[model samples]
Target: MLLFQKLYSRIYKYSKMLFLLQIIVIVLTFISLDHEAIAELPYTSVVLPVHKHTDASKPLYSAEVMTSFIDWQYMRENFLIDIDATIIWHDCSLLWNKNQGDCPTNSCNYPVTCEEYPCTDIRTSSSYKNRYCPPKTNWSTLPVWGLCTCPVNVVNPVTVSCVQVSLNYDNFRFNESNGRNVYTGWDDVYPHAACAPSSSLQSFPANVTGVLALSSSPYALAGYLHKPLKRVLGLCLPSTLSTPGVLFYGSTPYYLLPHSDVDVRSYLSYTPLIKHQNSFGYFIGVNSIVIKKRAVNIPTNATTKISTTEPYTILRTDIYNPVVRRFLKVTKRIPPAKPFPPFGVCFSTSTKGTQVGLRVPDIEFSFPDGKQWTTSTANSIKQVTKDVACLALVDGGAASEPAIIIGTFQMEDNFLVLDLEKSAFGFSSSLLRKKTSCSNFNLTLVNSYV
Candidate 1:
């Protein structure tokens, strides 16, 4: 019996040791696999938030650079967008074929067709040359001070000052959510896009494309960055919590910023874009502003027209200043802290017995499409100094003007998607866990794929 007991004790001890060994092997294997898995997925993007202690930082400038790749790569072929014009020539006998009655070679019997004096269409089927230079006889038509010539030969000239030729055109094509191509739908022909970065802005601007004339949204730069392979451009903006902002073009947005499981596409609440004359950027309607459960009245004429009873705010408008002024007057009940420079209304919890952020009212954004989003105090309020927090909003211009700009600060902690294919703007609340920085944003990608 004693021998049996000894044998049983030895076997039990060995079994316990084996179990622990297995657990150790499993843990190490998982650790190895986790890193290997990340390595295999080379294109997952990790972004950090951009932040400032003094004032709101410029994220648009950064975004502008990233999107320019589209112009540099894809928009090169879209240089010349066609418009309406005609091969018009007035008779001056400037050349031989234009010789009406003044040709040394009587072989030139071209008709003299001038629209102002109703020339006979009897020669309509002919090369009608109006005095290429108004005839010395028609001095009263003296406005013909300069010489005229069609640089290119026109074989078929109609008797009119203008002609209709529908080809590539110069117009802003804002992409709607449907990914519809505004250009001609046959055989995939898009308008040519051109911009001259080197040319100084001036009269007789070398860049006739008008694209290079002025920098505008989705046009000058942001509109250009479509991935050759992905055919998509993605923007990962840092949340107020300090996540990093990333502009993804020609690269995959494999992982959402600050988290891996959260897919930006899933959280989207879409608002169809308003087809305003301005196609420089995505335009949407703003209904009203609600603060702490109260509807804050938007000043009259906040938008060009009333989208609803509330003045609408569009994306990237310079309306921050006006809305802010009203915000200051309404939030007087909250104990005021020392105002920060440029940004006036501030709140502080570090006033001797107070917190660094206290008495700050929550800000809510209500849109014309019934989409409402509220900002956490972290987004609405920002730290300026060690002991001071100020309203992150900027105050601009007189309230008399319609100003309802939804700036980047207001967009903090939001996953904003600017889908050029759809010609629409969409965003959703970002689940933020921490403050991130762009200083060490390392992008991992497969060497085979850019």
Candidate 2:
């Protein structure tokens, strides 16, 4: 009985050890299965939100003003000014030709003809003859010199005289050395005032016509001083002219000084008679004052006149580096999609059943490796249907099975359905592994076949 009890205890101990070993093996097997399942998770190529750099700084100038000036300059310099004048004349001629004679008449297709005859005097016997001639039309006349008359006659020559009068009047002077006596008449034997009562304190000369020659006592003044005078007096004097005061006299000798500060100031106050002359004296210290006055009228909001009122959205994608070089063709089954949240897809293409490819419409694009993505079908392909299918290529030996990670499908007329879920990762990973090993595996469609 003692030996049997000892044997039973040993058996129990061995059994417990074996059970623990089995549990450990089961746990290890489970961990390995879990790992394999995780490894098999398919990884699909997905386009995620990529942040792009944007320029949010304000523009250097107002866009509206710049555009307006650009358009104005273009029209003025290119389109409007460069128009052919002959074309305008041709158009005018056509319009005149359409209005035949008086108006459009069903009876005549051409203009009526008119004849001219010179009338004979009753004293002489003369005859008139009818001549076939077209109507007196003056369509070749150009309006020059504000006249439509033809320039065929030059009988009376027209003369245009241009007289240039110098504003300088140095000969006229007032001598204040003698008693206040005004002597302004040049044609009379003696100085005469137009106003009577020579001492009435104010005197003006009367109307005196006819040319008269003058001989000055001083031979030094020959040409200009002794000039022939033809005066027409009694003309109304300007309002700016004023009679000299009782204390003033016309004989005051106002000598012209070389550099008189007072004269310079007075001359500057008067309007300049000569152009391109230094109105301010050479040594006059002149200073410019710039008054910055703020504009009182503020510009309102700019309103652009747009012909089309409909709004549109544009999608532009610039891919610098592509995954493959050769052409690739891919077809993915897209779900129903919407228009919001603007998005696009990028992929490569291939031909081999085991190689990925891009498929769109009638074209199939394939890409091998080490090439840029310049082949696009956005502009070429049109009328993309909802729930469309597309495919992309990976590498030459990569699996050709379509892994749908990005898709767009229309649910309604305006609503679109999109599926961006990465559920095919496990299957894709397993396929890639199997393909690398050159193992034969079923590549049937996942969801459809399953």
Candidate 3:
């Protein structure tokens, strides 16, 4: 009996040791697989929060640069953004140099040589006029005015002036997002852009260092980052200064959290995004304008375009007159106030206010395919004072080619996706009506996919 007991104890101990060895092998395999998965993961998308601020004169939308060239401490510095701009540019005069005692070791700015790819390629664009001039070997030669030494000269969309600047390439960082949560920073791509003098930034808001172009041009911000983004761009313009909206590069189900599993794209209505050969602006075909569900005749020849530079929509007199007449007729019951400059009609808001500004009638834009893009009273009317509100539409006097230019005010709180692949402009009219706003995107959520 003692011999049998000893044999049993020995067998049991061996079996126990073998079981632990199997557990160790399984755990080692799992760890190896986890490391490989992490190594295989490459960043797919870029996201930035679009900040809104009012200068002395008007509101401006901007984003900060996340790059190795700029000191992280000065991260508050930003770039003004224009959806119609054809190229990205920065004012280089006041940049921190490495020789400066306060400059960070990672921060340094330098221009690319004229012999480089982008600078060489700049000569090919007819718009640039081949203004690229290499640096003179001799110092005695008279400096040529309006010539680009190492970069190129391009027209500034905001000021409508020409800017001569140095060309630079840098790794621009963007925050990665899985729609539900922001993951990590991605900086693998190095895109080249122009750097102009600080004088080029006149009239821009203070602390704005550059301009980011979101136009359809091949050299625009979206094009340079297209490989990872898949030629998709999404923008949500915030209505207030306190809450910032978001700008993203990539395809989307656009999960703005708190509304779990809900995709904002599903709420969007798509229209064919038309590109004009002579213009960089985004245009769409509008069949007519309807006031209070009544169709107002719009000139068939007139074009409609969207703009972020313009604060309010501008309508050519021909289109404006008829629409305003119809609107005035509909709201004649409310007492008409004195005319405000630019705004042709005004009303006294002695009546109790509602969610959509004095409960005014909704204005609808009927499209070519019988689809409609409607704006509630919240967008159509602006309350300038406590007791007064004005019709936000401005008359552009008859010559404007685009009979209607929809501006940023009307676009606020709306989700817009410019899908280059589909060549479609998708819009979600007003997120406010859906009990959310552009500011609803949750930045603090921990992504399980991460």
Candidate 4:
């Protein structure tokens, strides 16, 4: 740890050496490094907002979004991200806890902008067990004053031990590029799960890739520390065709709703989250499908599960085409036109049906616990070519069972939450409330008392 601090100090002092020598030597090199990136360290304070087709204000989600490129092609189609985590620490002092120094308190900056981890609720919970970080002492002699951080190797419940922790992330996609590598020295406490770098994570062949092990789970950081909060993760998919979306840790979108101040219970729709393989994906049970408020005839054994295909549900492009054909047969809504060359059940935009091509009706999916998400036609029917618009569903390869993956396109303008504590998934199928500002979603303020 002392060596780690010295590296930062030297980098700070000889900042110019970085550009002049063009040598990129990271203290904690985690990702595939690019020589061009040797000029500067990855910036964590810079909040990145994913734009909707290049629009500025209308972004998908805004955060200290770490854009790390990969060498895969799983999520390239829908622009979906898979398996990420937010590492937060209480008491910036953790950076200096292992190794004390004579540097200025603020000079030992940890790159990312972080606030003290609130312990109000944890200290009060039975989980607290009187195991709290000692009260702050004025170590004025050292760079940082008395600070608390998660123990590097010791296993203390995050809420009680006051250690740095990671958040839960539940999307699955692969990036196949040589992007930037971001690292945080404060987070050396992970369980060190081994994950192969640069692998293609496609959403097909349901049983091809089993779930990731908890140890190797990148988002498992939440379970290590966010136990008191149940390790819940809330996400509101992009509301518009071009607008980006927002994701939250420790809280669900329903609890953060504009009108949820009173009865938050009424806003929750839950589905049992069955862990498939290990942590690879959350396998859900789809009871039935209803189109235009009418039930579609599904074979008895034809199973459906919601996988994290992101932007749109995923199935191999070939498999998706066949399902689209079956859906057309069941709905009898419109006749299929020429096949969309690349993939998908495409048709001419000029249909006898109303405004656009083969006007599709509302598709509703039933889940366990009476939870259901009805797709809105506007986002469901996608316009691909000048004269063609296909269903927004993603196309992947063939898997053993029929693929009925619930995608982000179907989840647009909706608030979804992954409640790790309860092992359930909660969501609001309604439109994203334009007035709701996640400012209150601040974890420090909410957990201040603990």
Among the numbered candidates, top TM-score falls to 3
RMSD of each: 24.0, 54.3, 10.7, 20.8
lDDT of 4 by residue, 1-450 (tens): 999999999988798876655544452242344433532322211111222321321122222222112332111122223332112221112134235454343323232111223222222333223224443212112235543322211112111133322111122211111111111211112222111111222221211221222221332434443222235655554544443444444432233334445333355678887654422345566665666555544444444554333446665444455456656775465555566633356656765654464556666667755667766665577666666776666565656344555654566556566666687777666553334433322122111111
How do the candidates rank by lDDT, highest first? Answer: 3, 4, 1, 2
Locate the minimum summed-lDDT window of 10 residues in model 2. Answer: 82-91
Candidate 1 lDDT, tens digit per residue, 158-267?
12122111111122222111110111211111222221222211211122212121112322333332223232444444443333344443224434435444345666
Residue 135's lDDT within candidate 3 is 27
Which candidate gets the maximum lDDT versus the true structure? 3
The true-versus-predicted C-alpha distance at residue 49 of model 1, in Å, is 11
Q: Which segments of candidate 1 are over 4 A away from where they belong?
A: 1-233, 239-244, 249-254, 299-301, 304-334, 353-355, 399-402, 433-442
What would the TM-score be for candidate 1 when compared with the true structure? Answer: 0.46
lDDT of all predictions: 0.38, 0.18, 0.73, 0.40
Q: What's model 3's TM-score?
A: 0.79
Would you estimate the TM-scores of all the predictions? 0.46, 0.14, 0.79, 0.48
Give every collision pair in model 3. Answer: none
Q: Which stretches of candidate 3 lie over 4 Å from their true place?
A: 1-44, 68-76, 93-105, 115-117, 120-124, 127-148, 154-158, 351-357, 445-450
For candidate 2, write residues 34-129 as lDDT tens digits: 777644423211101101111111000000000011222311110000000000000001112343364242121111111101001100111111
For candidate 4, what is the lDDT?
Answer: 0.40
Q: In angstroms, what RMSD does candidate 4 have relative to the true structure?
A: 20.8
